[model samples]
Structure formats: structure tokens, C-alpha cells
Target: MRAKVTVMLKNGVLDPQGEAVKSALGALGFAGVDAVRQGKVIELDLAETDAAAAEATVRDMCEKLLANTVIESYGVEIL
Candidate 1:
């Protein structure tokens, strides 16, 4: 099984890196971009075969280590 995880800062949290990218884009004359938010994607190859089990395992990983649940949110997609 394959699992994909996306981790992102919760809404209302300040994102300095995202802001820097946005500013840089504007400086580069890409003025249409009003905002930017940066996030991470993790792809994993798993031994688990069942989709439900794989998704559950990945979500547990996110809760335990992959994401800082207090300030970040995560989603899991099993493929």
C-alpha cells in the first residue's frame, strides 16, 4: 500500500516562510498572488494491504510524530 500525507499549518497561524514567498513573488512582478501558504507532503510505501488499515496507520503516524497537532493539521490518502 502507499500512503500520502499532507501537513499544513492550521488556519490563523502565522506562516513566515509563506509570507516571504509571497513578498518575493510580488517583487518579481507576480502581483496577482495575494497570499501563500506552505505545507509538506510525505509519501510512504507501506506493507499494509487494506486501505482502511493503511489510512489509520498513517493518521496515527501523523498524530504521534508527523504533525504537531496543536498548530498543524494533516490529511492521509491511501493509494
Candidate 2:
């Protein structure tokens, strides 16, 4: 099984990197972009065959170390 985790800043959180990208886009003449948000994706190859178990394990990983739960939110995809 394969597990993909997406980690992103929670709503209302300040994202300086995203802001910088947005500013650069405007400077590059792509001014239509209203805002930008940055996030990370982690792809994992797992031995667990059960979809439910795999998701649970990945969720645990996110809760424990993959994501900072207080400032970020995570979503898991089983592939």
C-alpha cells in the first residue's frame, strides 16, 4: 500500500513563504493571483495491506511527528 500525507497551515495562520511567493508573482506581472498558500506532501510506501490500518498508521504519524497539529492540518490518501 502507499500512503500520501498532505500537511498545510491551518486557516487564519500566517504564511510568510506563501506571501513571498504571491509578491513575487505580482512582480513578475502575474498580478491576478489573489493569494497563495504553501503546503507539503509526503509519499510513503507501506507494507500494510489493509486500507483502514494504513490510514490509521499514517494518521498516527501525522499526529505524532509529521505535522504540527496546533498550527497545521493533515490529510491522508491511500494509494
Candidate 3:
């Protein structure tokens, strides 16, 4: 099984890195840009064959270690 996790900052949290990128884009002549938010994608190859089990495992991983859970939120997908 393959699992994918996307981790992103929750709404209202400060995102300095995202702001920096947006500013840089404006400087590079992409001034029409309004905002930017940065996030991470993690792809995993799992030995588990059951889709339900794999999704549960990945969700657990996100809650335990992949995402902070306070300032960040995560989503898991099975492929």
C-alpha cells in the first residue's frame, strides 16, 4: 500500500516562510499574487494491504509525529 500525507499550518497561524515567498514573487514581477501558504507532502510505501488499515495507520502517524496537531493539520490518502 501507498500512503500520502499533507501537512499544513492551521488557519490564523503565522507563516513566515510563506510570506517570504510571496514577497519574493512580487519582487520578481508577479505582483498580482495575493497570498501564499506553504505545506508539505509525505509519500510512504507501506506493507499493509488493507486500505482502511493503511489510512488509519497514516492518520495515527500524522497525529503522533507527522503533524504538530496544535498549529498544523494533516490529511492522509491511500493509493
Candidate 4:
């Protein structure tokens, strides 16, 4: 089974890095740009038998290691 995980900072959190990128964009003459936030995606190939089990495993991995849930949210999709 294949799993794709996306981890991102929750809304309302101050994203200084994103802000910096936005500023850089403005300096480079990118007009009408608002803001930017950075996040990460993780793809996994699991030896698990089924999508349900794979999703559970991926969620566990996210909660345990891949993500910091206190200020972030993650979604898992099995393919």
C-alpha cells in the first residue's frame, strides 16, 4: 500500500519563514502576491496489507514522529 502524508502549520500560527519568502517575492517584483506558508509532504510505501491498516500506521507515524501536532495538522491518504 502507498500512503501520502502532508504536514503543515495550522492557521493562526505566525509563519515567519513564510513571511520572509513573501517579502523576497515582493523584492523580486512579483506583484499582487499576498503571503506564503511552507509545509512538507511525505510519501510512504507500507508492507501492510490494506488501506485501512496503512492509514492507521501512517497516522501513528505522524503523531509519534513525523509531525508536531501541538501546532500542526496532518492528513493521511492511502493509495
Per-model TM-score, in order, reads: 0.97, 0.97, 0.97, 0.91
* Candidate 2 stretches greater than 4 Å from native: none
Which structure is stronger by lDDT: 2 or 4? 2
- Clash tally for model 2: 0
lDDT of 4 by residue, 1-79 (tens): 8899999899998888889999999999999987799888999988998888788889999999999999989999898
The C-alpha stretches of model 4 lying farther than 4 A from their native spots are: none
Per-residue lDDT tens digits of candidate 3, residues 1-79? 9999999999999999899999999888996898899999999999999999999999999989999999999989898
Mind sharing the TM-score for model 2? 0.97
**Model 1 deviation from the true structure expressed as Cα RMSD, one decimal place:** 0.6
Q: After superposition, how far is residue 45 of candidate 4 from its true place, in Å?
A: 1.4
Q: Model 1 segments beyond 4 Å from truth?
A: none
The 0-to-1 C-alpha lDDT of every candidate, in the order given, reads 0.94, 0.97, 0.94, 0.91
Worst 10 residues of 4 by lDDT: 45-54
For candidate 4, list the clashing residue pairs, or say none: none
lDDT of 1 at 58: 92
